[model samples]
Target: MSNDNHITIYEHEILRIDRGEKRVSVNQLKALQEFYGESGVPYYSLIHNGVKFCEYVGVLQVGDTLIEILPKVDKNLTDSEASWRKVLIDMLHAVGLFNLQAPSSSNLKLNSNSILDLYFELFVKEVKYLLRQGLVKKYRKTEGNSTSLKGSLKFGKHISQNLVHQERFYIQHTVYDTTHELHAILYKVLKLLLRINTNQSIQGSLKSLELEFPEMPDLKITEATFNRLHLNRKTQGYHNAIEIARMLLLNYHPDVSKGSNHILALMFDMNLLWEQFVYVSLRKFKKGNTTITAQNTRNFWKTSKGSKSRMKPDIVLNIDKADCVVIDTKWKNIKNYNPSPEDLRQMFAYMKYYKAKKVALIYPGTDFSNSSGFYYDHDKYGAHEIGKEECSVISLPYNTDIRQWQKQIALDIYNWVEVNDESSVDC
Candidate 1:
């Protein structure tokens, strides 16, 4: 490939730099430094002749002039493969950009120019639907000086400040208002979307929506704001849409210093993405007397100075008040279909600490056969007798149809647990 300003590389693939060409410019270096400082994850790895890339799988702008480099797709996927498109869809869904209630059509394909393009397209669609229904409104408290004292009077402030003018008295009223939490959230979303690099259509749509929003100062929305929202018939429809917009805006942190030269790119770690997908999908199986928990943490070891170390299992199955099964999701290709020693040791710790009947290690890929023997027996694969507790390494296949894949995963898990639970009871 010739020395072009824009470059795209795949995941785990190294890009070599020519001896004469400048690889890392000063401005790119500064932007990268700032990105690392803010995100705390090294986006790229610099080596002697080239750079070893990491989790970020999107376009990155380097230098003050904003030269764009598109990172490589996953190590398993080729650039021209249709699977890359699926990966993009999964990425959007993982970040709550896609609506979960409306399942993605099996035949639907995105003609997006870029990831941000697709995001803005969907965002505009949802916003338009919301507008058709009219914006959500609530009774917000209004405080000001009133001549007739329409609401509760602040006698202390009224007497101190307005004693000279007996005509006006300071009062507060809880009036039915449209400019409440929902409008504040929507306003922030519009502002953040405008900052991103998008097409003319999206830009025009956002501007139109902006005019429709109430004239309120952008409010810093926190987790508390989401919790405080009362979801009845009126606000329930907008809940998911508002949340998706809120999350995207919150996660968006771009280098605005490059002015108009910088490209808008959002990247997600496959490791974290796989974990989140598994956790969310597993929740479907939570039936009577059973509960599913993700990122379940507990102190497994204690230091001599009284400090405690924690053990966090990715997914935990609590059956009848006991931690029955612990699962850990891995985002790597297993060699010879065997779990690595390090992964085994980690799962072993969970089994010991939680007294779990079984521990499962899940990976993402579809090469393996979905047969019964896929699960590793106790003595097999060097996971010999620590106890009667069983350990299984399962692969969750990545299919173009994500909904079907998720359903298969739920069934696999349910069956695995049902068989194991019966055997354990007999023992």
Candidate 2:
């Protein structure tokens, strides 16, 4: 209920506290229940009067109303107060949230002095970008009584209202509309963020944005609407900003009755986030004639006479029209640079099915020595006489410098694939 008790946590991180230490109030419990009912997953579990909070990873948001947990700050906290700003930008960019054409500048730092400051910064930036290019407009259908019959006549309404003899005609007009659904979403995000962010500067920026754009009733942005969004040359500049705005709106769970203070905080799942980041980076830096597929699951193997399971690898690399590599990213820290038995078996199955000569298991962390990479001979690893296939474990440290990390990953991928270039194995 208070800022002192609120703790910031990262995705997949658990928080447990005893009743005597910090008990969940009845109102907060109700809010949690409502959240679970809507999301079908409990944000926090209760055990014997103690609270075990589970924060979902992916995007960042505030969950102050339902729980006392906040987003975890970087372990190595800095005095500059802008340490996490670059990381946030890189994460957003990896997920295709930023326009590639937009100019990159370090001046675009976040005001992350507080829990929701980063979010506020992104919100303001998006609003300013949209304004610079102007808001998108479309023609919406309008219906009412008018002197001119511009569209189809509503004969039933005219007769029922006893205005048939009058000069007024029930008609419809397709007027050019400026208050499009996208603008409505933008307006909603600004309004919600403004309410939670106590920073006066952010609040003032939001107010200016609101005045520039027409006000519309808050609308829910669903997957359907997101898919339906289209862009042409005129509206292309707003594409990235619109996507960021949509993500902001999707994570927002606003309370209709209580207003902005009761809005559910935004958070992103770290596992999925890491996977996506890898996929995006690989695709972005892929070499010529190399095609990478994320979560490719078209192929399947029959388990029984009537049952079969799909083989959906995290990433499938097709080089020069051949299935060359099967790479799976692991977010966990590998102990002693040794992958678990289960992971080995999974990789083996993938190698056999894809007929890939090389399989790389990518992990996070930089402490491991890069000089001696983990490699296993297929015969020694229970491959029998199925020729010599190689499986290696590579460490990809999560660096705040996104460009450098991506470049290293791209180079690593190229080297791994080229290792088997001499063999000429066809799939």
Clashing pairs in 2: 7-70, 8-70, 9-70, 57-268, 57-269, 58-268, 58-269, 59-268, 61-266, 62-265
The residue-by-residue lDDT of candidate 2 on 175-212, one tens digit each, is 88677777777777777766655556667877887788
- Whole-model lDDT per candidate: 0.63, 0.61
The top-ranked prediction according to TM-score is: 2
What RMSD, rounded to one decimal, does every model reach? 6.7, 5.7
lDDT of 1 by residue, 73-141 (tens): 235454453356456566457545566444222222377545555666666666677777787778878
Model 2 regions lying over 4 Å from their true place: 16-30, 37-85, 100-107, 113-120, 147-153, 162-169, 217-221, 256-261, 282-291, 303-308, 318-323, 370-388, 412-427
Q: Which ten residues in a row have the lowest lDDT in candidate 2?
A: 65-74
Q: Tally clashing residue pairs in candidate 1.
A: 5
Model 1 residue 335 CA deviation (Å) reads: 2.8
**Model 1 accuracy (lDDT, Cα):** 0.63
Clashes of each: 5, 10
